[model samples]
Target: MNKKKTSLLPKNFLFRLTFINIFIVSIFIALSSWAVYNTACFLVDSMGTMTGTNQTKFNKTLYYYLWIFSLIAMITGSIAHFYLTKRLIHPLKRLIESTKSMKKGNYPEPIEVTSSDEIGQLTSNFNGLAHQLKKNHEQRQKLVMDLSHEVRTPLANLNGYLYALKNGVIEGDPALYESLYQESERLTKMITQLETLKEWDYISEQSFFEKEMAPIGKLLHETVKMFEWQLKEKQIAVEIDAEDADLLVDKEGVLQAISNLTENAIRFYSGEGIISIKGERLANEYYIAITGPSYPITEKEGEKLFERFYRVDPSRSRDTGGSGLGLSITKEIIEQHKGDIGWKTDEAKNTFWFTLPLETACTSR
Candidate 1:
């Protein structure tokens, strides 16, 4: 049998105060009872000696007085305990009720606590948490909607082509087959891009593996070789202006980051396409900048280039075979490196540029 998940109400500082107040009132009652009995005995003794009354009579009178005192003390203590408990617990009841309202998916107005005690602090914290949670929830919903729209189009086309082939809706020709295959490839690429974005999202909120001093030249060498085949097909010339610069980084991750940018350069920077890899070091940071030619790019578009799934020219990006997440992922990686990444685009010559930070060593770009 599956166990049902149940949570107990969270205890707070007010609960602790209730227990302490009860204990203190209990001790006060005990002390007050002892004092009442002693005073009654003292008065009874003095009256017996002064009036020369019989011991039995004095004892009876003292007994009656003690009884009356006990009765009054009991009533008074009961009333005080009830009052104290009401004072302490009423605010908490208000808080609990307000919090329950939040469970109904509304950010309730915060309950005001009068005492300058821990409960007041708790109320403030609760309000802050509710605001933050609401913001994050809204953001998550927007992200889901965007991703669904992005992933659905290619996937629908891919499924449609498969359906056509299976039912023989059209003649079994090579062009039809090829078209289906291309659509499938597009769908697969979209999935891969989504996965990459998901991984970075995970990484941003997770404890990273580690960082070490890594040489940029070697990282670039390996990355270039990995994508060398694609660059060759495009006939895009690649140039490196990097020297031996060691940067503090996660080596494999940094390589992946640079590869994403370079891939963009190869794909979009066309017609005398020059991908210049340049680097320079400043105080406490080294900068690696990628200079490449772009098409019909504007300054405003360049500023928003790193936004998720945002493309300067969607048709150009899709035709050149990219999922538009390349720049976004590159931005994430750079941010993880404790740095910033940005680009500038020139409309005349059609050039796009991006830079990365080097935290711990030499400079290579």
Candidate 2:
């Protein structure tokens, strides 16, 4: 048996380009031939007696040359079309392959940018997307690990206590009961905050905010009131210097954002220091900030504070109990409202501030 011979023409896109170029060349040759024939006829008619043997020979030669030129034009057009189309489509082919790799949970190496064109820009954007996906994947895996450890520790303690009680290995007393209750409560709080964090994450992704015309001062006051007991216990005075302004915002979401900032301030406040809560409108934006005692943190550390499960204090003590999801949730909430949230620290104090559009539309960025 003989092997079938492969066609030399490029396949797929290149083949289509080849066909198109040949068709265009054929049309151009046909139109040129028609024009030339009409011009020759005009010249023969003008030369009245010149239409003889020479005219016949000239017509034959003209047709022969036209055929040869048409063949050359078609061949040249096909070759050029194939070469250029192949080069243009090579980047797209790589992009498709990279996307396939990403679909399989593999982050392929960045494709080299070969030109300063739209194609290069597209390649650059794809690389950026891949980097972000890879980063998110690593963060997700880390979050799961952290979540398991957080849940397991408290459950293990509860299991141990229950087992001891059942086997009569330890006596059930007030202190023991209180300890078990605290463990359970901690576990519940962690789980609850985790749920809240996840909820806000979804809300942020969907850009879901129930906007209402709410008084900024009232919202700030309400958030402060929620921490009244804690404030009194710590002797931390909350001074609210807010100007009354009606903002188009999600009432509950803004309250939660303010509450998270206040909570963190109280948790890390210097002894008997004032927690300054300020709200004001500057130009087209509503600014809200909670300033408290400065912790030992750098600018980079402050940036990471908005990330889920990222704790500012390394101790992770029960006294300052947090699942490290509050700030993350707050960030999501503020962002969903097309607002910006950030923290700034001086030597004496750190101010966590967020800004929202003063004249916010129902569905605006």
Candidate 3:
């Protein structure tokens, strides 16, 4: 199936707006002309009857003057509309062209427009989106390259092992056999994780999960318990502060989201790093606050943290067995559960958190 392109030609937002304005002006002009003509005739009829002059002759001159005045008014209004439309059309065209270039996978070039109006707001938005898209595209391409490299290493080792065995270069020693088995298993696990990520992303994209009344604390506990071994192994201390915490969300979807987030925390935390999982029910919403031990999450990195396959430290990330989709998939799942997600970072504090709705949890609160 062929896809239709949204960005191709320069759209005229200003021209469209001017067209409607012109239509309204024309209607007002017509109504005003009718009223003026009627008033002129009324005055001529009243005064002409009193004077000793030809009433029909005076009425003819009055009608002629009204027609001339109407023509002049229409012409002036049209010229004004044209000028306004011109002022609006040029910038709009520039914006449309920018969008088209971006749609074609061109990183948007820097655009500067000084006009302070709705059009300027649009320009700012366009520039921001373009910048993000360009950054994301570059990062995604790099991630794919790195991931392929990672996967290839294990597979190549396994293939060489098999070739050696077949050619009788290496005997069927248990140690060599175990090494081959381990490499193949590592490759298998990587494939499984990638597949699971793809499926989670698909489900999230389709909006398959629907909102429901869910016990957030219980799910958090369950997810945390599942990672108990990893948490204990790392000497990471976890503190849970749950008082009145419930949310309106997709049950399984929310569980999967927090699980992914916690997994990420476990992978990144240092020895003796403290992890806190807290939940609070606000008047209109419920929030799950997951704060892990600090690493370098700068302000800019926070913005792109949820982006697909974005890694802060590629070397450290690979060492920690991060596939880079854990946080990204968690973000998508939270959105699907009819919730919101965000992170905070600073010199002293770096917390990854998300919020769910409390509208349906009114009773629980």
How well is each residue in 76-187 modelled by candidate 1, as lDDT tens digits? 8666766676676666666666676777787777667577788778877787777767776876887798778777876787778778878988566798778777777766
Better candidate by TM-score, 1 or 2: 2
lDDT of candidate model 3 versus the reference: 0.72
Superposition error at 201 for model 1 (Å): 1.8
Residue 140 lDDT, candidate 3, scale 0-100: 70
Candidate 3 local lDDT, 82-102, one digit each (tens): 786777667766776777677
Tens digit of per-residue lDDT, candidate 2, span 1-365: 12112122224556777687788878988899778877986787578775578778777777788778878887887788778888887888788778878877799999999988999999999998899788778868987998887778778889999999999999999999998998888778778887887777667646355678888888899999999999888777879998788888888888888998899998877644688999887888888989998565687777788877777765766546477778988988888888899988877788999999876622222
Q: Candidate 3, which segments miss by more than 4 Å at Cα?
A: 1-150, 161-186, 205-211, 314-317, 346-349, 363-365
CA RMSD of each candidate after superposition: 6.2, 5.4, 8.3
Tell me how many clashing residue pairs each candidate has. Answer: 4, 0, 0
Candidate 2, TM-score vs. the true structure?
Answer: 0.75
Ranking by lDDT: 2, 3, 1
Runs off by more than 4 Å, candidate 1: 1-26, 32-98, 107-136, 167-169, 206-209, 314-317, 347-365
Model 3 lowest lDDT segment of ten? 1-10
Candidate with maximal TM-score: 2
Q: What RMSD value applies to candidate 1? A: 6.2
lDDT of prediction 1: 0.69
